[model samples]
Target: MNGMHRLLWAFLVAAGLAGGLAGCASTSSTPSVGVGPDGKVQNPVQLLGQLPLPPGAAIRAEQSLIIGAGDNWVGRVVLDVGRDFDAAYRFFLETYPAQGWTVVSAVRGKNSFMVMTRQERTATFEMVDGGMLAGSVVSMTMAPRNAAVMVPKKP
Candidate 1:
């Protein structure tokens, strides 16, 4: 992680996302994602649903942190995709554009990466090959495009 990544992590942590970070490792039965039993929207589903995810992707909530709401949210979402590095990497390359994200950079390797931007936000995907037992870990970090800009000081 770089300075920007550290800053974003700090922001999310400060925004009270740390509380939601728990229970991601617990397997206890809980309400289904997206909606509660009352039929209202749930937080996890609301946030994760906005992204273009691979089929059967399982979220690793312990390793994820999300802030904001709707289409303007920014944070990191870690997922375990049941595919190899190549397949998982290709999924983003194809799906991001269909969802209006413009691919600015992509690298294919043992640990692949892709950076995409849309509207006022940018997203970076880090795909680490966990191999057969653990599968792949896809860490997607999103932030505002102007979040890190340093305006010139007026003399």
Candidate 2:
């Protein structure tokens, strides 16, 4: 009976060691991007960086709008580009803040980014595409408790 007890103890120790080694070996090397409650990426640009973009396309213009109550802000960014929507979107998301902007939420398929704000207001900007294509438009909208308000400028 003593010999059987010793064998079970050895087996438990070996299993524990194997599990620890496996856990260490499975550690992820890729940096973590923002993820939603469901474990899917919450930022589209981050996900775009992981995918391939279209060819010979450039971003032409980008705009952002911020609106909300005090301490509660919603931001929206629109991208105007020539062709490579994916790359342009990623670039705007990764670079715009360097020019003084904050990104709140980013959705890739829709081609837009939401900015968080402390005040209630809307801001917009433009970027020149310079590519052969005439123009492409991308819009982003964010609402903390209600739908975002977007108003088109009169031509």
Q: Pick the candidate with the highest lDDT.
A: 1
Distance from true position, residue 83, model 1, in Å?
3.3
Scored by lDDT, model 1 comes in at: 0.72
lDDT tens string, model 2, 15-90?
Answer: 4466457657876543445544643333444323322222333222223432321223234434444555555666
What TM-score against the true fold does each predicted structure earn? Answer: 0.71, 0.28
RMSD of 2: 23.3
**Which candidate's TM-score is highest?**
1
Q: Compared with the true structure, what per-residue lDDT tens digits does model 1 show for residues 70-135?
A: 566678888877757667788899988988999999888778888999988889998999888778
* Model 1: how far residue 45 lies from native, Å: 3.7
lDDT of 2: 0.41
Root-mean-square deviation of Cα positions for candidate 1 versus the true structure, in angstroms: 8.3
